[model samples]
Target chain A: MKLLLKKGRLLDPTLGIDFIGDLLIEEGKIKGFGREIEISEKDLEIIDCRGKLVFPGLVDIHVHLREPGEEWKEDIESGTRAALYGGVLRVACMPNTKPVNDAPEVTSYILKRAREKASVKVYPIAAITKGQEGKELAEFGRLKKAGAVAVSDDGKWVADSSLMKRALLYAKNFDLPVISHCEDPKLSFRGQINEGKLSARLGLKGIPASAETVAVVRDLLLARETGTPLHLAHLSVKENLPFLRWAKEEGIPFTAETCPHYFTFTEKEVEGYNTNAKVNPPLRTEEDVEAIKEALKEGLIEVIASDHAPHSPLEKEVEFELASFGMIGVQFLLPLSFNLVREGLLSELKLLQYLITNPSKVLKIEPPSFKEGAPAEVVIFDPEERYLVTEDFIQSKSKNTPLLGRELKGRVKTVILEKRIIHL
Target chain B: MRHLLDIYSLSSETIKEILELSENLKEILERPIPKVPTLRGKLVLLLFYEPSTRTKFSFERACKVLSADTMSFSAKGSSLEKGETILDTVKNLYALGVNLVVIRHNLSGTPHFLAKHLKIPVVNAGDGIHEHPTQALLDMLTVKEKLGTLAGLKVAIVGDIKHSRVAHSDILGFQKMGSTVYVTGPAHLLPEPKEAEFFEIRPGGFKICYKMEEALRDADVVIALRIQRERHGEPFIPTLQEYAENFGLTPRHLELIKEGALLMHPGPINWGVELSYEMEKYPFQVILEQVENGVAVRMAVLLRLLSGD
Candidate 1:
């Protein structure tokens, strides 16, 4: 069977193509695309894509599927469905789940479940250390062979410098990427929000920006010394920028990622004790937000990921300090990142590169593009569309975002995956 | 006036009204029969998630003076200790036809959380280090009773200002009432002034006095807060002796203040830590009067919130 997508603005950051064109799909693979494709097949299914932006589906390098445990919050089926609604066709799940994804068995379990239940592709990121205890490193070779894309101790940092150094060198032998969750637990101990006047006024303990910068500096030095390519996850503070710049200038191989919440909100979001705005490496000051946007624009920060930590109201609907950190973000990743383009920080294509191309490169996978014989992982997005973020709008089982009841521009109109066309 | 949550949001006129009501209530406390039938049928729930002796007693006495039924629920031997959430426990209490909730918890914004979820008026007894509205009101009442006015008074709050909910409330309350609030303590015990500047609700910010004498000089009132020895584990202060020597108030310091200036402590004061034991014997010391005023001020709050007076 053949399908024709007629007259849409196609954006392929990988192929560096941006123009209004028609795309053809045959047997669930991209057949060909040009200004106009003349298809004379009577059995061809044609979809009108006027006034829409068509692009390769997004690749989010950080997400939490919460599978094999905590299924009540989110599992592979529900999480991938959320990703599909957000126009992301590929995601790398973090290892900070219940029982922690450290061993090959957990990694294999995630992959097997994803193959059975997920609508989108799922890449399991195994823990860097056994049980994420930060003392002993996990078996990197076995985990990589079990289909794990990378290793990370995401919820906690590898506090021991020697242990982290060993893990960096050890993961290198297996050709596995090392993702570091940069934070000093001692500095951020019992911290609720960004350490500043807000935390002081609110009377909650503060997590100083030094907590992230200190960890970042250590990780960068380790990566430089070990010569292992490192991926820093969900960096939220401005103080880390100078260190990141210094590392880049020193020719250190590293990729830095910042989430939408880091650029979109600040500590002020927790002004009324908003639990949904509480996150680890907590939301920082307005200056930090500006610095993150500038970093993205300057290409110093190459990837924009959704650290989509899902927590039910059981964890969120309590006292601000007692409430768990993080908000569900996978579903809002694209629309929120699109605001970067709207604010003129980055062009639409460049924003797409951060969302799609850069994240794919971090995971060491081929990005989805409109090449012949490539899988038809495409998305139709309506940039002008506006919708309110409500419980029903979120496909994730947990609705724990500060954006709830707020209207957002841009939405996923349709997603074309191999053998299925899902309209959202 | 539905909830006595924090002094930061209380207006100058509102604070004056509570003080005036407290003045009238203090007169009733002097009566042979202090009991009033105004809120005889109302039930005030004292849900203290944290251990508190004075705050709970003050609220209970206020309830008794107003003739309102009181029910006390401490965290020990309660559903809270059995892994039940504070929200669920509060909701269960609210379902029992409780009229008003006076909550104190270890976490900041606990009262705010209950106030958001509950329909009946919720009073913040004390929530973490965030606020103690009634305590601040009572402190304001004590000062006004002695000074006759809250406006234009120089008030100095000394010791453990960073962790003192009373200090947090007093700074905002006094500033709202037109007092220039000055705070001095161990450097680590003092909160950054920039943090308070972010609070737009504050009528004016407090002054951070690095030297105790700077805060005490010519001040109309001086409040010494209890320094928690438990905080030593966190490196806030080197030792209680060091804090007392450097920041504590004594009779010798009295000469630095105005002739008729009063010394206040949101007791139980750390006798030798925040204030010298000799401070209690001084004629200017009004520690007992502050406790007396606590009942009256809380009565004013309960009456205003419950009877809509």
Candidate 2:
């Protein structure tokens, strides 16, 4: 099968290309095109990218598809559909499912299901330990061989430094990056949201920002000593941004990503309905958001990932203490990032670089770029349209988008993955 | 439909009818066909802005037992996302034909807001510090179930007197049942138990053991409010160390009180804070008994409010 995207302005942030070109595709790879005449429209199927700006498809390194053990909420099929609608072609899923991706079998199980179901490229990041229990390390080499792109103990961190160091050292042999969810569960202290005045008044427990930064400081040190590649997932707390930037300067082989919700809202938004705004590492203060924004602009943070954890509506419909921590976020990431970029917080090119090229570099999976001969994994978007979010706007089975009823600008027009237009 | 919004909405006459219906429902639970078609054709909406395992889950379980469909929506996933002003979110829930709103918001006037907007009756599970009227009704049901009467008895509500909405709503419900209500706690915690023209305060702090002893000595029923652990941060009591020493319920506490005084507590008890673990298991503890009665009383409230009698 063949597909052609005609006369689209290729905005290649990595190569600095901003000119009109035809994206020629055969099977699932980009053959060649642009200056040379391409195949006829009737000879092959064509997508009219006439006035659209085509860029490398966005990728999210953090999303929770809540599959394997719990398909009632969201499986690979539904979650990839959401990523497709939001202009994401590749995603690194969290290993927080019921039967976590700790073993090669579990990782292979997710990859096998994705092949049969998902429309987008689903990269299964295996758990660092069995069931993410933070105990003994799994077979790192075996897991990587069984189609696992990276490894992470995502929802909560591996508390033992000694154990985490061993896992990091073990992963180096396979050249697999060890992604970490840097948080000290002990520092959470049974708190729900951020530690502040609102938590005191709401009478719920508060998790301190130091709970996160303390872990990042420790893990970064560990990565430096072990000479292992560490990727921090959902890096919240302003203090960690400087540490991450410093790590790169020192050549510590440390990289990090932050979610849209961390930049969009804060502890203040948790006044009434405590659960939705209630996530682990908790939402930080406004100062934290400002710090994260500055990092994005200064190129300290590498990529933006949607720590998209979807809980059943029943579990979240109660008091703050009883509700689960996490909300479905893939359906809103692109629009939200666009809102940030349009607000002068980040340049369009810088934002897309994190969405595309930077994530590709971290995962070591090259998404087909806008080069003359490459696969046509492209995202077509318009940064001008404005829209309101509602229940109907969500594509995931779980209705946990914190963006509901939020009116915002910029919508993902269409998303193409592996020469197939998954969203139109 | 599913929620029991408030107690006052049920009149003195209608209240009796609902209690009898609860008795009938209890008998049905014992029989093979525990299922009821009362809410079979409808949908029950369990919406709690506040947390409630018993009231919320029991309502859901009741909906299941009745063979009725149910759906739950917390503030997290709903319209509370767009900020509160332009999005009440309840209208959309109502448009979906939600038969009831079992609301428990932290704000004092939230359920009343639903009452004003929706034609479907609301079951006010609990609203901020204002009232948890159904909880009061359930405590009364528990008393009547065990003692076989609620009239002409002295019932004392002790502990966390200032913040317990359960204690606030119970005084009124108990008074309507012809019981003389007495409210006493640490001096900083209690209000003079309000009864129209009468008022009386408990003397001194938790140090004043004589006052609480006197209050519980002649009581036929004793309701101890659950003291929140968050209050340990408050300057009011001086310290949890001081409060536990004086007010902590112990075996001595149960012995000093009247033998016939039925003991109770609203649960998720802090084993060492206001009440003891022994008090939780005490024959008079009746805390677990309260949880069971909660379901029955809630069934009564749902029947009366939804039947529109």
Candidate 3:
């Protein structure tokens, strides 16, 4: 349908456009913007976005929608609706499912379901090996050709150096980016949270940052040797952030993404609140959070994916040692992110680049834009909207979101995907 | 499943099940082809940081009964003497994919730490003076073998209770299974735990005659605890002459008790200080039976817990 978003403050960072004008849409493409545009009689709808700022829809390359194999927690329909509600138009789902999602068939199954039921586009990341066992590499070329976006062995690491080097070289042959969740099992055994005063006080096992840093150091050397494009997911351990900084300064063809919780919450949150704040990289101290925030502001972190790992409430309500490893984030990703920019912790330009340009580049896509004749995928949000992020407000099937009870500024007012108004 | 880490972590039901299952294993032990295929594909590594001849041999024999392989390592000339962290050494051993580890250490509560750190099961042969619960279980097995029951028998666990893991584990298991348990030792050796109902201290000379007469009067079961000489900074007994007179149980001392007062000790014993050399082979003395029961008790626990049945 033809629609016009009139008189909005347009900040399309992709085109470096900041103007107050009407954006005309036709056939799911931006027909014109920033000038007085006469709409055709065939124009279907026009809305006044008087004080809103229109932006290019954000893309997240690391998300777990729990589809195909385990849908009791979330399906493609519900998860994508929540994504649209949060102003995310494209999301790449991780492929650690019931059957490990190692083959081309599972990857194609995920793509077909996403096409049939999801409001937004979905890209499935295939497992690095058969059953993600890290024993042998999967058919990366066939999986990628079957629409798997990238390769990852998410829940576990590919430990054997020789096997990982081969997987990296094989993915390189297929031009598939290798995403690694770097963790050394021996170093991380029995560790419940970050090793520090807090973990000691609670009598929980301590996970040292060395567990993360050593893995990062190994991968960095592998990336350097193989000349393969490696992406680090949920970079929390502060010592590893410096390597990403080094990777950039040395012009290594590598990239990394840090989650919002790594910058927003610290290990102290898990100190008294119990298991809800517990996660895999295990939260770190305020010093680490400050380093992540500084890194995000400095452009060392290429993307800020939510890493939205959803789990059932029963899974998290048990003993701290027994609870699951992830927290849901998609429903509150936008407001929590915009709060960072509004609070002056991050400049608007940095936020835009992290949410849009960097992820587009990481996923090797034609960068999204709000320019004339571009795809009409945009997010209009109010910078001053105030609300408390609570379970009552979230649209996801699971209530494992860490943002619950957090008061934040800003809200996505409208989402225009394919000339369709999917949100309000 | 092949390891027995601690007694407390093993449930009462598991203990009872193992004791009952031992009746079946006894006949098999007498056969020429005594081995079974239960653990044919498995391997056990008995690594000890402390001295243990009884438990070490029993575990190795138990592995043979199940037709499994065994590798025993002591601290005498191993890499551990070169100062490697226990976690590192264990991880390296685990890399070799060893299925089970039987560990005995000199520190109290060391088994719990190992259990938490390792993915595999760790059997605590003995950990300091805290627990030798399996030893206690086997001791009970020996007593039950002669007496044919464990109901309301007054069992006095005499001598050095504080320095005795066997005594500590026995006092609890005995009381749990319908036996009146008591701790009899010099007040210095068995100091009352500020508040306890199980002990009555005899803070003076426990000469062989006097202590035996007191312990023998109406006792249905008399368990003489082994005095660990290494625990004492000074002489544990004032004099060997004085200890022989006071705490030692000779043949004459045994005559003061009832006809059959079921004599027991966790052996590798001092025949003179605790029991006379002849008393060690007394018909009712079932010391070896306890060692045999240890494996059966451990197997019941391993099967119940790991099988999730």
Ranking by lDDT: 1, 3, 2
Best by lDDT: 1
Q: What tier of docking accuracy does candidate 2 attain?
A: incorrect
Query: Each model's RMSD to truth, in Å?
Result: 1.7, 12.3, 17.2
- Evaluate candidate 3 and give its CAPRI docking class based on DockQ: incorrect
Worst 10 residues of 2 chain A by lDDT: A197-206
Q: 1 or 3, which is superior by lDDT? A: 1
Instruction: List TM-score per model, in order.
Output: 0.97, 0.63, 0.59
List of clashing residue pairs for candidate 3 = B5-B124, B206-B246, B207-B246, B207-B247, B208-B245, B208-B246, B208-B247
True contacts kept of each: 0.70, 0.00, 0.00
lDDT of 3: 0.74
Question: Candidate 1 chain A, which ten residues in sequence have the lowest lDDT sum?
Answer: A197-206
The per-prediction tally of clashing pairs is 1, 10, 7
Q: Give candidate 1 misplaced runs (Cα > 4 Å).
A: B193-196, B199-205, B229-233
lDDT of 3 by residue, B58-100 (tens): 7787777777678888888888789765666777887887777
DockQ, prediction 3? 0.02
